[model samples]
Target: MVSGLLWPIIKKTGPLLMLLGLAAGGYWLNRHYREILTPDIALGERLYQQGVDGGGHALQGVTQNDIAFDDAQFNCAQCHRRSGFGSSEGGNYVLPVTGTILFKPRTFERADLFNKLFKESQGQVFRARMRSAYQRPAYSDESLARAIREGVDPSGRQLSPLMPRYRLNDTDMAALIAYLHQLSIRNDPGVDEQTVYLATVVGPNVDSADKTAMLATMREFVEWLNLETQGNLDHPNFSPGYRSDFAKAFRLWRHEVWELPADPRQWPTELASRYRRQPVFAFIGGMVNGDWTPIHDFCEASRIPCLFPFTDLPPTGHTNRYSMYFNQGLILEAKAMGRFLRAQKDPETRTVVNIHSGEPRSSQPAKTLTQSLHGDKRYLVVDLTFESIEQLRDQWQKLARQQSAPIQAVIWPGTFDKTIAAELPLLARYAERLLLPSPALEANQTRFPADIAGKLYFSYPYELPTAYHPHAFRVRAWMNTRDLAIENQRLQFNTYYALNLLQFGLEHVVDHFSRDYLLEYIENEAENQLNPGTFPRLSLGPGQRFASKGAYIVQLVNNDQRQIHPVGDWIIP
Candidate 1:
């Protein structure tokens, strides 16, 4: 009788167990579905930042305070590490939030929070569940937030016993959001304001009587600057439209000093005293035409860099406060030429003829052509000599006649003696030439008609600031640079790359005018902070960067037409 009674009790207990199991199962399914669909704002941020701008953490710059969340951890960097904040309770290395799991919420976004909750797998990552919580859905975002700060949920549901709400104040919440918003920033150090100032080199060029007065005025300006802005090189907190009356007067004075006649005495001393209180700054540079060593030495002693031809100068290691913004030696010119030639390929013309100037390797001159030349190949070796260029052309013509080769083109370097052209008849039609590579020739870029100059290319001795595209190069012509021939597709490709290197450096190293304006600008960096378009204009090529070492190559159409190009242009072996 006892056994029979036990069986009935066992049967009743089995039904109760089934009812409990089904309830538990239903709750889990709802929770899982919620987590998968509405993921979070952080997911979107991760995708946008990591993929765009070529990879890095995404920052919405949204701080915990922006959304009015109260937690010292709103920076999202502090808590669950990398900010997803979910830890598994059970499966593999699991410990879950012990409290209430509210549905997920998309944190830190202007969009409807619901849309940002789910994380969509990119590529195969979507298909495989892996360790990702994306499929299972994250912890109920609201429940989690409540659990962290308050021990209870919106429904007064007690959450993981481990968490207790520590009420936070309003001030702390605002600060948190502010910090997050601040964090989501792009760290691009673009060129600061295009500052302008006068640099004068006082010499015999100045009047003796005016010199003492000028010196006194300049020192005063220095004193004024020292007192004004605290010498910060970065942007000072000045509003956009403030009138720089004092600075304008100085800039106007700059034009006077820069364009000063051979004799400073020709100008009135009073005007000079009023604006020329700044230091005497010299334009130091190098080119083949003059002795540039002293200027080079002065600039080097000052650590100023220049994009000069491939010459090596040492650090100042000196007492001179001056510096040079450098232009590397002739190598920059050569590399620029290579980029120009590589861009100009047509199927019919596979051969490249680089006629550079160098000492003859043998007792007699021989053509040194790039061995890489192949297909549609052709080359011409025109040796340089004092004899009229006609003599050299006469010889080339004779050879051309014997070989029946259609002497396609001619490229000449400035390093050659132009008088040699009196002999060669083929180079007279230089304007019709297709390719000229050199900083100097390119300086006169726009003048060369792009229509006639097929596949023409050139490099700025110094490129523009952050010149990511060719539009900057097209604008360079307006900066008084020689207009370049954008002969169809070739120019569209090469000018931008060449421009990126040169222009960026020029703009970067020469941000300031001379040291005195710098000192004053520093003192008034806040007061005198110029916009990106401000003076010292950073203009290149309009004036021969006579101070910077630069060179160029020009092409001459192989014709008997009557105008010759610059000397020492390239010829093949």
Candidate 2:
């Protein structure tokens, strides 16, 4: 009777008890796994790149002397950079916070001696040799939180006051740390132990001779670089001092030419196929005849750097991060022309006739010039579009018949040749002043007549031919030594400048091999006297994609001597 009574109770309570136990265990496991494996990486990326949090609010921080800052103005990407490889700026070293660097124990070695010296110099390195090496344990999650929140390192040492202490809750902090843990952990796609691969995109519209010149210059530079790198590695004398430390950064450079298809629509597919076959670290010294929007889109999508392509047309109206141009190309020239016209004191120059071949390259600038002169009541802007050279001649004749005042004529011939050169003299007869695009004069400098040259005002983007630039001589000397013909000075010099810039940027990087890091260095060091005199000046800063910022409205002076002079100071509009 007693056993039977106890059996009923046991059966009823035992199953309920087991069920409750299982529920508790499951809950605990879920929480543990969620904390370890399910951080919001997308949220972390937002906070890192845009300085916005999960709630879409700007993140806040405090720097030296408790100066408050928001992510809108100063985000992590601005300093540590998108790749998490920190940069050295104005003697202050921003330490790398990537998982590759943070998750491992930090030990001081002879290779890092220079970095340590600069980092710990406190604005002066008078006795840097006397400083001792530093070591710290790998960061635990809690320590990382403290480091971010309190500006402290894993070794319990205070970080530099320049480093900002961010205000983040546990969840946001966890997400950010998660992102950092995986940032730049693997080597970039195009690099290996011994060689780094690069590519240059040659558009379908580029001339055969221009393409040949660009490719030859790039190949010669690569060959010379590889030879120098090999020599340094093989020589016993290079193994002794700081040179050996930097020798680790040296790698043989191998490059490929990515030629796009004829159709613009197929360019993306062609580029994708090429990239799929083999990825490249960057695109350098590219040349394209038409719009560069397709290549720009491809580069931005793939997170690759497109540096200094030779073109008169670049993508418009979009903010870019990976592509850097020498200038705004045709757009810059057009805006400069508008500003030049508006500043004129002559009241007789009232009507401005903007004529183009209706091609995208010419029409876009024609439209841009109209927009720049939109509200200025001093001048009336008129747009004339033509289909061909024959149509352009007809349109010019029509304008000449209707012309009344001493008007100014701006011609944007999409393509320049002997036919276009022949029309310049006729166009000059109708207008008091004639302005031609840069390419018009560049292609037919020797073909213009003496009478037409006086009225000609070319939208010149580079340094005037009359100006003395010492760097030009140096560039020519280098080309001469290499046995390269000087057929296109602007194209060849710009190519040579691009190669030199790549070499400088790579030297500064010293084996980090992050595309973002390379770009950051280029932006910071672009104006350090590296200009090869193609432009008046070449410089870039944070978020500045164009290196040369201004242009001149130059007048052709002597037709026989082929000399041109700027009418005024360089205009930056």
Q: TM-score of every model?
A: 0.28, 0.90
- Model 2 Cα RMSD, Å? 4.4
How many backbone clashes are present in model 1?
92
Clashes of each: 92, 0
Candidate 1, residue 194: the lDDT equals 31
Clash pairs for candidate 2: none
Candidate 1 residue-wise lDDT, 1-573, digit = tens: 559868988787988989889999989998988775443335333332231111232222222323333333332322222212222212211111212212332122212111112322234422232333322233444444444455554455554333323333332323322222323132112122332333323333333434433333333333444344333222232432322211221211121122333443442342244334542323311222212244445444443332222122222233323333233323334444443344444444332334333422110111212322322133432333323344545554454445332333334443333332332224423222334334334223224433444434433343332235434444334322323233322222222222233322222222223232222112212112111211112222211222234433444343233123433333111
**CA lDDT scores, all candidates in order:** 0.32, 0.82
Best by lDDT: 2
- Candidate 1, position 270, lDDT: 29
| Candidate with the greatest TM-score versus the true structure | 2
lDDT by residue (213-315, candidate 2, tens digit) is 8888887778878888899878836558777777767788888888887888999999999989988988997988888988999999999988999888888
Q: Estimate candidate 1's alpha-carbon lDDT, on a 0 to 1 scale.
A: 0.32
